[model samples]
Target: MGRNTRKRRTPLATKIVAGAAALAVGGGGLVWANFYASAHEDHGGHNRTRSAGAQVATIDCPDVGQKIRDVPDRARGEVDGELATMDSQITDAYQRLATTRRAQAGDSQFVQNSILGPLKDRRKAIIDRIQLEINRAGGRADDNLDELAGCQGRPADQQQDGGGQNGGGQDDGQNGGDQNQDDNGNGVAGPVADDFIDINDVQPNSRNSRNGLAADGDGGSTGTFTTDCGVNENNLFNSDNLIAAPGVDNGAHHTHDYVGNQDNDAFSSDEDLANADTSCQNQGDKSTYYWPVLRLQDGTQEFDANDQGGGAEGNIGKILKPAQAELKFVGSQQGDVVAMPKFLRIITGDAKSFTNGDANANTSWSCSGFEDRQVTDKYPLCPEGSQVLRTTNFQSCWDGQNIDSANHRDHMAFVQEDGSCPEGFQAVPQLQVRLAYDIPTPTVENGQVQNPYAVDSFPEQLHKPITDHNDFINVMDENLMNEVVDCINRGEDCQ
Candidate 1:
């Protein structure tokens, strides 16, 4: 009697309903667990990505950019080192030359010696090479500096983001309540927003104020937020836009008259100025301009013929005459001295009637004439105690005396008006003229010769004459030899 119902068992419909409800609850739990696992996996998978992001952030540091931008300055230091080395070499050469001159002062063999020719030539070549290298290095440094300056600012296109949220629901004040569900019946959060990140903040490799994220739950939600962590403004790798520090302008070539003058005249033929302008254009400087001859010496004046008071054809002599005349006139009138013109030109309408003296008389004087009277065997003797004497036995004579064979002569002047040899038609070696008169003995110092004459020390003029061509070639060879030796010692490329 306890209930015929218990004996009869539960109805089939009721059992089926209970089983279905249990299955639905279990399925909901499984889905929740899967969602949690997915979130965790996403975080774990992003470890490498986060690490990369951090590295990029560090490079973005403003200091790193600044450091990279300083490359030109660093290069300049290297150039300075090279220049110092060149300077040392030049100094050594100069000192050696000075010492040699001193040691050879009283020695006849040394005084009239041609030993320093090769060394002199080498010095000039070295100087030219060093100057060229300096110019190249300086130009490179300037270009690099310009590139660095352009990197200082931000990119043209920038964006902002707010992390993983919807654009609505903040005003509802529904704390922890799922007022709205996504397509999958999951609760959705309101929009997350952030402020703009400043460059200073990002300079120290800190996180930027623009952080964003995407999440998938019911439908999907994106999260965006900003942090105050600074940007890496100093990262040279990332900061291609960083500005570089400027360099000091050295005075080299700044005071050269030709360079200054060329800059002033628009019609100047200087190719260097044109090259400079082109370089400026390539650098994207639309407004860049240069003016030449910026400053003039005191008391300097420019005259224009068109001006009313420009005075007397703009002649320099006329302009300076007043001051000069006053001084002369005052001296003559008050100081009992005649004030004569500093310079005078005699004007003769006809050459034949200019003077009463014999025009064709042999007025030319000769040192050899004096020497002949003093020495019997020597056709032309030099003055007593003369260190070097000119000998006519050589190609060209100096003041009627024979040219010295050993001395490096730089220039020669003939006693006669015309530089031609006597009508004998003797073939004169032009090289002898240069070697005897062009180069001068090196200056001597306290009883010692510091720089012994080398094949490379000849004057530039000595290289020109056809007869001296071999000597010139020899000098060049000696220079090349020395340079090759130096290069080998330093482990540098040598030709």
Candidate 2:
């Protein structure tokens, strides 16, 4: 079909324009590619212009992965260290407990002959050392655990910038910010963390919940004696004996287990016996047995027999005289002495006259005879013959004559015009004149004697004679019982 539309010779202008346009487009495309490459390079080979929602290609960093991996190892090491410290602390506590137990035993010294003293000391030392170690280890373990817990992985952004002052962020890394801010917009500091680890936190067998250390068993310590045993503080601390000497036995004839020389004995002293010893047989025996006599309110004279006789009587009252001007007499022995039933009332005239016609003669006296005798056919016109009637009889009694050799017959009594007590004499229990029989020999051991009688039995022939009438009246007073009880409780010697 050769419609050769005469191939018009192409216009040089159009062809040149078309060629230039093609060249321009190719150059522009090349410039765009270069710009893209340059942008990617600027952004560390990342798409700088990518939208937030666009999918991104991931790139791995060998250094970062290694750093992340090292974190767990560090944490594990910390935990191991903490465990080691805990073990050390537990061991120390056990050691200390053992040591304390040992030392305490030695220190107590319950038995003086025991060889456990050294062991006790060693135990104490060990306990002290263990306590110190536990304290140190506990603190260390606590710190290490806290550090490990705080080092848990933080958000990637927070890690890059170093975690906030309080470690992870305010929102717990959900949102990064200061977490310690108060409602007033003021920043508050974190809690003061505990530095010491409690054993209870980790160990199931911890003794932290146990009570304080047990008390020492032996009562060697003064503290224990007072607090535990209720012993008197003075007795425990000063080493004083709680049991004083068993004083004189009055009001009964009894034997003492611990006997000593009757002289200067603490239990047998006249003063001590009167005050402390309540048991005396011849409590009111002024002529023979001597004791401190006290005047009671009812016009009666009372004395503690226990004060007069040592270990012969238990704590009890012994009345001496019954009424005024009443005289009592004993046998004609050296130790025989008359007991006055009551205090005497001196009268004037022939009643006070002397037999030898001497105005001041001691012959005219109220006398107690050994036995009531009638004016006998053998001796008429003679005054009643008292056992100590004549001076000869008096001398014989003083010389310890044919009376029972076992009795204390050396005691004698005489009338004095002035009614003055003998030299070195004080008011004592009025004496009882009796026939001397068998007097037990003093045991004399450890400077004292023990009482042979049971504590409950009363002795024989021991009478509570009333010398002062006023004392008799007061004894029946309603408040007398209360007073006696009070005196006894107060440690007052009540005769």
Top candidate, metric TM-score = 2
What's the true lDDT of residue 275 in model 1?
A: 30
Across residues 58-151, which tens digit of lDDT does each residue of candidate 1 receive? 0000111111211232243333333333223322332232223223222323311322333334434543443444456553222232221110
lDDT of 2: 0.19
- TM-scores vs. true structure, each candidate: 0.13, 0.13
The window of 10 residues in a row where model 2 has the poorest summed lDDT is: 466-475
Task: Please give the clash total of every predicted structure, in order.
Answer: 77, 69
Looking at candidate 1, the ten consecutive residues that score lowest on lDDT are 324-333
lDDT of 2 by residue, 163-193 (tens): 2122322212233222211111000000001
Candidate 2 segments exceeding 4 Å error: 1-247, 251-320, 325-397, 400-407, 410-495
The residue-level lDDT of candidate 1 at 362 comes to 12
